[model samples]
Target: MTLKYALPVIALVASAAVSAEEYQAFVGLNADHYRASGDSETNWKLDGTYFFDKKVTLGPLDQFEYINKVTNVSASFRREFDTNITRIGGEYFAENGLVVSAAHTRASGDYVNEVGLGYLVSNNFIVRVNAVKPEDESTDFMFSASYNHQLQGNDYVGFTAYADDEFDYFGISSKYFASLGEGRFIAAGITLDDNDGSSDWSAEADYYFSKMTSVGLTYNKADSYSLNAKHFFSQNWAVEARFASNTDDSTLKTYSLGVTGQF
Candidate 1:
């Protein structure tokens, strides 16, 4: 997608609403090499979170990837109402949009704000729906859901589905944990996407070496593939390298390398 087309969707999503718990703080440098276009770009990223109290937190996040030359940055604030009740929060994306949300627990059942801004929560599943109104354009609604089951210990399976005005996709994924020498486990997933009646699928596999090293490979029905590897030198430091290619059309390829740190 071009910048003009992407910026609006990103802005709309940001205006609507958005998770991983990796590090409390981090910064990184990245290099992206695009073979099909014979172009190389440098990227920088920084992100951090601060706690004001046991129930309140603030976050400043920023990231740069070589996709359409877009950079993402956001400021977020979250407050926990109680341990298993409602947690209210909102985020503002720089020059983008604003999102407000609340998350509840299964014991608390489902909830909807007076303005329709809440999600359904359960012990094993979650569903969220939101609407976005961008200036001078039609409103877009997005919905996503995930279901997870724990077979035993850390072994589990999951299903995810997402839909919006212009996109629809669904995926099923699972991971099995065991001791195979230095390797800990393997994970696999397949995603099907309906892109305006033209459907495509992608498959992915990942192997984890301990908790600090891993490699992943992905292939799409559109004749594109990607490989990425990550290794941590310490609990607080890591490096990642990735390569991607498309065999069709101009035969494009992209490579990236990054070093990261966590507080």
Candidate 2:
């Protein structure tokens, strides 16, 4: 590869090694192969959340900790195509069902900041809005709302709407679970994404042999399909593998393997 592309990739890999996400933490690597381009990439990711349950005074300022029932600090790093993206954020959770979060992200040499507010309207619905500002770029907004209702054990239907600068879409998704045997269960779901002019849909089915092992298949209206499998060695560690392909122009394909751990 040319030096122009190589330097950024090297820097990203180095930066990701030191930086670390969710209330659940994970680190993983992905090996990806592109069929059409005959190129391959190895991606590294680290992210997780650490929570402070008790109030601890930090210097002279308590900030919002007085009203914060739960303080969660999160960090994430992604290294791909020889470039690095890093994010650090914190969330303040209040007992009155309000959550506020702020995060800063850096990519290459540019930076962006995001602020988000969310509320749990009820047990089945949530509304969220996020404002994102990137240095030297136009500020953008994203809004999302979702509602889910359970009909029986582990079976439910849901609706979601999402909007951003480029396009707005809304759709419904549902999961219906059935017992296959003594310790096996299967689930099937369908999702539709209605864009500004056209609509795309996908269907998925997953079979779980136990609580920790499952395999799934997905077919999208975009003439793409994927097969995926996951196995958990323990409560804290798991691995995943997937193969995907498309039938459109270029007929691209990909294969990937990754592992994750929660702390």
lDDT (C-alpha, whole model) for all candidates? 0.51, 0.68
Please identify model 1 stretches exceeding 4 Å from their true place: 1-23, 26-29, 37-116, 165-183
List the candidates' TM-scores in order: 0.59, 0.71
Q: Where's the lowest-lDDT run of ten residues in candidate 2?
A: 57-66
Stretches of candidate 2 off by over 4 Å are: 1-26, 50-72, 165-181, 187-190, 194-198, 249-251
lDDT of 1: 0.51
Candidate that would win on TM-score: 2
> How big is the positional error of residue 125 in model 1, measured in Å on the Cα after superposition?
0.9
Clashes of each: 0, 6
- For candidate 1, write residues 1-263 as lDDT tens digits: 99999999888546323211233344555566665565544433333333221111111111111011112222322222332333232322222222234322222444333112323354456565666544345656767666666554334566767777566433333333332443365566788767567778888887776556778898989889989988878766789999888768545877788777655
| Candidate 1 lowest-lDDT run of ten | 60-69
Error of model 2, residue 104, in angstroms: 2.5
